[model samples]
Target: MREKLQHVAGRVWLYPHDPDPEAIGACVGVIADDRGSVLIDAGNSPAHAREVQQAIAAEGLPAPRWLVYTHHHWDHTWGAAAWPDVEVVAHSSAVDLLTAEAERPWSHQYLRDQVALDPKLGPSFRARALAVPDFGELAIVLPHRTFDDALTLPTGVELRHVGGSHAPDSIVALDPGSSVLLVGDCYYPPPFHLRTDDDGPDLAMARRLLAEKHAVSVDAHSAPRSGS
Candidate 1:
């Protein structure tokens, strides 16, 4: 099912999905007063993006005005291309990775690995996965404005670039008034085989950081876990 969480103050809707048995990620939606909205972390494929779009339509929310990628990973950013003429935002390092991927030839082997890792997807999903061009041809639009440590959105949301734990340029968003923090993939549930040759969490650091907030903490995962 399409899991959801609501932020009343910001009118933000968080959609969570367990794409794999051990892994979960979320796509965020922020509704503007009467204007369009913004999306955070498009899912792993255009199909996922379309699913998000359909959900928004069902809810009568405004179409996403922008797409914000939490980090530079396939599961989070691969569906970005589905949005038309929308501004996409990500860290500089993320842009570098997306750019690099766009130029290389499509790798069927990599697609196979993705399928093997997430067997929940069907044959059509695999087709779209393998069809993605390298980063160069992927139309990876860079962030119009880049931030080093901290940045605030027009809606009075403050996002801070916490030091990299999951990837070289990961950032966390904190809503001081509401005490809600959006941490990307820094602290995934332990069940997933997180430790890998290249990417995973710095468990000790993540644990410490996770302790700071006494309020709700959201990740690109299934649900918002308590920070306390």
Candidate 2:
């Protein structure tokens, strides 16, 4: 239901902010270059994915020919099925995780597990999941394509493996063509939302280390465009 796109820098735009208020998903990124548009991360769910797909169409940009998964987090990876046509790209490690997760069907017990993960936020998350008409519905599509530590796409987007930030398979995409580096969830996520546990993605505290490391790496990666 929300229709908004943020042109952050150059042709770099953000369908920023998670449509689901309680979802851990972060803002989605889009890079519209001479080659074509590239989506940084998918939204939180099938519906969320469709919403962003429509939002991209509303922007008058060409459908994203490519999708780069910054990491394997659910909020970013689950919606990938929405764009079965795009050339999906992700880190090799992420490929393993995504493939493995697809075999596991989501159930109401998943909510109970979340509650067990964080006593503070668990009940609320469980309630939200229950509220969704089809919360138990689960599906995931592995990337038709993949990469190792780094890759360069035709759109002039540079994806370098910058894990040890959020997820071990995390990557920071540098788009000299767009003058924006799509770091995915590598940037600081909301502090309170950091729930690093045996079951969660990356530990929230680990993000600080990721930020520190990615800051140096991205700056080096963007020096020419930034004139630094």
Highest-scoring model, TM-score = 2
How would you encode candidate 1's per-residue C-alpha lDDT over 1-228 as one tens digit per residue? 354445534465666655563233345645443445667677766666667777777777777766666676666776777777667766666767677766655455656676588764445345445435443334444565556767766655566666554566677766566666677775542223344455555677667667785377676754676646
Q: Per-residue error at 105 for model 2, in Å?
A: 2.2
- Segments in model 2 whose C-alpha atoms lie over 4 Å from true places: 19-21, 113-132, 135-137, 187-228
| Deviation from native of the Cα of residue 122 in model 1, angstroms | 16
Q: Where does candidate 2 have its weakest 10-residue lDDT segment?
A: 215-224
> RMSD (Cα, Å) of candidate 1?
5.3
TM-score of each: 0.72, 0.74
Give the lowest summed-lDDT range of ten residues in model 1.
Answer: 187-196
Q: What does candidate 2's lDDT look like per residue over 51-89, in tens digits?
A: 778887888977888988888877776677767578888
Q: What C-alpha lDDT, on a 0 to 100 scale, does residue 147 get in candidate 2?
A: 83
**Candidate 1 vs. true structure, TM-score:** 0.72
Distance from true location, Cα of 29 in model 1, Å:
4.6
Local distance difference test values of all predictions, in order: 0.61, 0.65
